[model samples]
Target: SSPPSYQNGLWGHVGKTKTPEDVDALVGPRPGLKGEGHLFDRLSKNRDAVVVLDEIEKAHPAMINEFLLGVLGNGQMQNKKTGETIDIGKSIFILTSNCFQTMITHRYRQEKDDVAALESLHSSLANTIRTWVHSGVSASGKGE
Candidate 1:
């Protein structure tokens, strides 16, 4: 049988990974970072790779705002500790989360309109994502 996709390797309980150094370990580290291999580099070697990041809401905020911005925005991950950049333009990352479900259920539980609830939830989530993307100290020069 074919092996599971590399995306299947993410460890749970991501809140402990506090900084960019921890972010490098979570994404996978390179020799330059004092580690053996990088998942982004490995996946990029494939002609087509779909990377899945499950439970994204649980990840450390620093990793998202600091490390992930470079990769998700520019298709390049700059490992601040190692001063190495890994090219991730070829991979597609699917991020999944269940965090909003509870809020949606509780907030609109009394309402009977499913469509409205969904729309409201979408707007809230979009605003939250916008805040997270722009909350950093420096603005991203590269346009999305």
Candidate 2:
């Protein structure tokens, strides 16, 4: 279960990322703002909090390769500016994306069997997302 005001932590406008600094702002403490980063600050206040990073596919490559890899792989991240280690082991992260919505919808409409369509879509989406994440290129074939 999530907190009632979980919407407060929604990161809907995580726009283009040009540098590591942008990644820091999302997961680590900001450059000059002491102890202030969206994910870090939310987890610091409430370990049970649920944070949503909407449209994750739009995030920069550095964000996926650097911050997300560390967080998802290790369950923790170091605050670059504060030199503090933030543990995300207890926090719930919800990543949302519409990368293949159209394809999925079209497949479902064209396919007669629901189970087969779901299986095919699942396999395709998984492989595509895995490739995009590892190769630093988005599903759109655009390098961020």
Off by over 4 Å in 2: 1-12, 16-21, 29-35, 138-144
Residue 26 deviation, candidate 1, in Å? 2.8
Stretches > 4 Å off in candidate 1: 1-21, 28-33, 78-86, 112-114, 136-144
**Clash pairs, model 2 backbone:** none
Candidate 2 per-residue lDDT, tens place, 44-118, comes to 667666667666777776677777777878888677777788677876677677878888788888885778778
Model 1 TM-score, 2 decimals: 0.62
On residues 1-144, what C-alpha lDDT tens digit does candidate 1 reach at each position? 112445434222344455555556565554456652244445435524666665555566655665567678998765444556667676677666666677767777766477877687779878976764576522532111
lDDT of 1: 0.56
RMSD in order of candidates: 6.5, 4.5
Best by TM-score: 2
| All candidates: TM-score | 0.62, 0.75
Clashes of each: 0, 0
Q: Which 10 residues in a row give candidate 1 its minimum summed lDDT? A: 135-144
